[model samples]
Target: MKKTEPHSSRSQQLEGAGLGFLIGFAGLLAFQLLGELVVRLLAIPVPGPVAGLLFMSVFLLVRKRTKASEPEPLLNASSLLLAHLSLLFVPAGVGIMTHIDRIKDQWLSISVALIIASFVTLFVTAWSLKILIRFMNKPEPE
Candidate 1:
């Protein structure tokens, strides 16, 4: 005769089989919803998801400071999401294909705008990095 331990073996199995992804996904949605609510209530111009992300980031920082006891489910979910991040771009790719004709008409302008924006972004990022490095290297005042 054998005795089975009265633990969450079912949950453990489900988690191993990717239930963590669902929980993580749910957590993401909850944060997004919370963000949306805050944006609506505060009448902020920022997008709801962005606000939610900011909130989530602050929560993580606070949790870190408090030395959270349990494992962070978001970390696993985020890893799984990142693993298949490319899939998220499919809708945009499909949209482009759907609007290929419209895009064809504006191709040159779009190309120029994209190129200019890319260069500007690179320049700004480089400038910011230079300033940051200078600030970090500055000696403390006596």
Candidate 2:
């Protein structure tokens, strides 16, 4: 197909966005790997990805405090990720496939456990939020 000026410009913008997304993904992956290394070396019981997330959070916090402006490309990349967040479940779906036999064998127990756990989590979260709201709405003495 022959390129029109506007379409060509749009295509160039998409390519640039893709490059930016790759850069952002690489940065995130680097932090996760770094976290995994730290967790493995230190023998921490927590998940490596959770540690990596904390590390990333701290880095973003510091970046916010120190830099006058954050990287726009990363910001866009993050938004793009969040916009299509369900795609992140592909890994979990694949993992289920990998362990399909085990899951099938214990499907009933797994379903029950998941249901109970979900209700418990929902209740706790709601209770905690209610308490937080009450705390926030309380009047303080001068």
Best by lDDT: 2
What is the Cα-based lDDT of residue 142 in candidate 2? 34
**TM-score of each model, paired residue for residue:** 0.75, 0.67
- Candidate 1 deviant stretches above 4 angstroms: 1-12, 15-22, 68-70, 135-142
Per-model CA lDDT versus the true structure: 0.84, 0.86
Model 2 agreement with the true structure over 1-142: per-residue lDDT tens digits: 9756775887899899889889888887888899999999999998998998899889889999999988766677668878989999888877776888998999999999999999999999988877887799965333
30 in model 1: Cα distance from truth in Å?
1.3
Q: Give the TM-score comparing model 2 with the true structure, all chains together.
A: 0.67
132 Cα displacement, candidate 1 (Å): 4.5
Cα error, candidate 1, residue 80 (Å): 1.0
Q: For model 1, what is the alpha-carbon lDDT of residue 138?
A: 71
Expressed as tens digits, the lDDT of each residue in 1-142 for candidate 1 is 7989769988888877576677778888899999999999999999999998898898788888888563357877877778998999998887876788988899999999999999999999988877887789975443
